[model samples]
Target: MSTLSLPPRLLMGPGPINCYPRVLSAMATQLVGQYDPVMTGYMNEVMALYRRVFNTSNQHTVLIDGTSRAGIEAVLVSALEPGDCVLVPVFGRFGHLLAEICERAGAKVHTIEVPWGEVFDPQQIEEAVQRVRPKLLAIVQGDTSTTMLQPLAQLGEICRRYDVIFYSDATASIGGNAFDTDTWQLDAVSIGLQKCLGGPSGSAPITLSPRYVELVRKRHHVEAGIKDSHHHGASGSRIQSNYFDIPMILDYWGEERLNHHTEAASMLFCARECAITLLDEGKDAVIARHKLAGDAMLAGIQALGLQPFGNLQHKMNNVVGVTIPHDVDGEAIRHTLLHRFNIEIGTSFGPLKGKIWRIGTMGYNARQDAVLHTLQSLETVLRQQRGPITGTPGAGVDAALAVYDENRQ
Candidate 1:
């Protein structure tokens, strides 16, 4: 265990995608006291940094101390009450996850499920809302399991007309695609650093709109002195978990500056750096890079006679689902790539497991070399395993090269 050293893998997988070298460096900086002026200064900057990153003027911008799931839980428990109904438009695995969480929170969960690789239209969601009159409309913008990106813009406007709160988990596609929290009327959105943001897991950036804030603020009465006085008020009902209380989180981020847990300093550092890097490159430019990488990766795979998995038009630009060849052991090929080629890709989950491979070109790894190398390595390994092949592996590289050149020119 002491000698364990992992290779610098080309991470072409679902997520915790390759973090930027700059982010890694920032995480390694010397630690400061949790409440030290310098550390809190950085924390304040983290809020500002992610505000720009999220493209919102939301005053409730802050990071959760846990993974993306923690952020999701925080929003659900904070915004929901017992007996409230929530409409979830399920197109992939993550939507089911949101439904499950809401169910645990005692929400009357209503689901509108589609095929694995499909997404809902605004009309379908409106129909569901018509049926349920849900208090909240929760869905995923991008579901990595199926490589499908459910459109959010139209759903936002529709939900507002229905008096429903809108929440989204953008963990899989936030930085890689076009997202506007304010203009889209999202009540709340949660995202992780592990994907298109180009940083590690263990933290999630969340944004909340003022209307949503006021709605949840109804639940915010926690005073030790008068704890038992208002049994009828919203706060009288204990939140499922104390660790994820958003009113408390808000107090910590707001001028109250109340002490909760000592913040995750290093994670905050890395998140700040990731957002800064995004801003430095410009969000539009970073998205354009992911677009190019996705296109090149798709072109290369198609050149190798493989078909992409999903509705090509609706797929997230950061991840692609590829059909696994008939005679090839998908696991063995992935293992060989990890051991020999020093690259890593992924397979799918649940019903789609082993049927498709998910290759990612997200965050810092969305580049010419990463895309081309993954295609070339996959081709070589498939050939050695006596898997069916097309003309030449070099052709895939050349196709990607042409794309890269075209982009530059």
Candidate 2:
């Protein structure tokens, strides 16, 4: 096989944003044994760093050795038993994903859905929880499919009142938006390094409150080969998937240093550096940067006379969904932007496919230059395609600059 080679293209999409150079550099470092002192130290540091990133004091913060979905599945499979009732509030694609995973875990999944662009009201969720009296509430904090961020603060309280375990998949919104795992009373939260963390996808950093830990521990089971006389079998049925067993994963991460699977060391390094970079910049400041970039993108797109998808008030700070103008072929425009301009934006999924464009301002790409360049290149591509262009040339750039200037004060 030939050595790897790739084209240079700007990723301005909903996820897997360009990694921070520092994170890439970190990942390129030499490897160490999983139980090596230095490796374990780095592991401990990662747990601590992510606690700050999630704004939680939970002692159970650790990286699941897979993608964000792995973390989601681990939590659901460990916490739920067959026929257990799980309530999912579906606002967009990820919401549907949670319900599907829960069902696969043998949960009796009950879902309440809002339109793609809208978020659920706390009262609405409370009403559903009271009616269902579910064992758990699983939801997505942000769904890039519609560029919407569901409000989770009040839902936590509702879950607590109803004695429901609250879990959120914050893979898309964690670093760029407000998420207080402790303050919001979220029992378990899972996140990915790819989105606002400015790292490549692989590691899933998750935090579980003490209550969640206790619940998961009840279902813990040692692997047959690793079992000892002291090791008791799981109180509940063995979690369906051995690889996704959270208790075993936690033992691997904890001081016990028990082996579950070999740690993905490079990805751990990448995830660690991503958290370090965010904390060094200050979480509040990083979130503000994303907000500014998102605002600028929104203003620029509006100046170009394109209406944005979804309710503006509930949109995520990391991405914007813009309506594809009439008479314009969305895929052709996206292809032109990628090949001709060396820039990439995303297309919508499911019901929104071909109807809108998803442009992201996230991680390292959440900068003035990236946002302006995307807008400028898009305008040029639209003009070339003879697509709708209601505003005068350069209006988008001017509007974006105005937002930057205003935010500078």
Candidate 3:
């Protein structure tokens, strides 16, 4: 086999951005047996670390071994029994994903949709909840496909008033945006490390409120293969999927030391380091950094005389969508930026396909230097493709620098 050599790409796409160096290094550390004290110590520390990262005292915070979607599935499957009603407000592609997962888990899914770029108002959701009487309210905090951040601050109270459980998948907007798991009164929340945690996409961090914990524990079933004399079964239905059983996963992480699956040791180390890096830098400081980079990117795109997609007031701080000019070939521009400039941006999904381009400022790449470099490179490629510039030459870079300068003062 040939040596594995790849270009040093600057990932300005929506996710799977460049990971922090410390996280990569942490993954390379020597591994111990799964039951070793050192291994369990790291696991306990990771759970504690993510409690702070998620801004909750849920006491059941843990990492799911697969990608971000695994966290979403685990939460939905564990909470929803057959014929449970769930109301999903669809703003973009991932909202459909939540609804789909609920359906697969045998829920009677009810949905309300706005256009792709806009989000629901709290009153609209309240009306639906009153009419449908769903057992759960499922939503996504940020949908990277449309670069929109749904306003979730009010929905929790609506769910509480109706005795419906509140849950959100914050995979795309956790560290880069304002997410207060406790202050917002969310019963359950799930996130991945790849976006704003400055890590890869193999691990998911999840938190559950005491109310949610009591709900899942009702369906608890210890795997027969691993059950010992002290194990006791609950009267509720046994969870269908062994791997996604939250109670079993909790037992492994809890003082019981029950075995579910062989832990992904490397990914655990990576998850721990991601949380440590974010906490050490301070959560508020990291969010401000993402905001600065996102603001600069927006200013730069506007300076290029290109209109952005969606409502600016509700956009996320980590990604933006730019409208493709009718006269230019969007794919050709992306091709040139990738092959010639060693940069990577994102494309849209579903109804937005071929209509817009998505660019991201997230995690380790959320910095002034990365913003300026991507702006200048995109400006060069656009000028080359369309011929004859519109406004001042190098206006993109200059406008972005002005944003940084203003923030400095």
Task: Output the number of the TM-score-best candidate.
Answer: 2
Instruction: Kindly list the per-residue Cα lDDT of model 1 for residues 221-266, writing each as its tens digit.
Output: 5555455232225443555566887877887877767887789888
TM-score per model over all chains: 0.96, 0.97, 0.97
lDDT of each structure? 0.88, 0.91, 0.91
Taking the tens digit of each residue's C-alpha lDDT, what string does model 3 give over 1-409?
Answer: 9999999999998988999999999999998999999999999999999999999988999998999999999999998888999999999999999999999999999999999889899999999999999999999999999999999999989999999999999999999999999989999999998999999998889999999988888774646565432323454566678888888888889998888899999999999999999999999999999999999999999988988899999999999999988888889888888999999999899999988999999999999999999999999998888733456988988998999999999
Give candidate 1 misplaced runs (Cα > 4 Å): 1-4, 220-236
Worst 10 residues of 2 by lDDT: 225-234
Clash total of candidate 3: 0
Can you tell me which runs of candidate 2 are displaced by over 4 Å? 220-222, 225-235
Candidate number that wins on TM-score, 1 or 2: 2
In candidate 1, list every pair of residues with a backbone clash. none
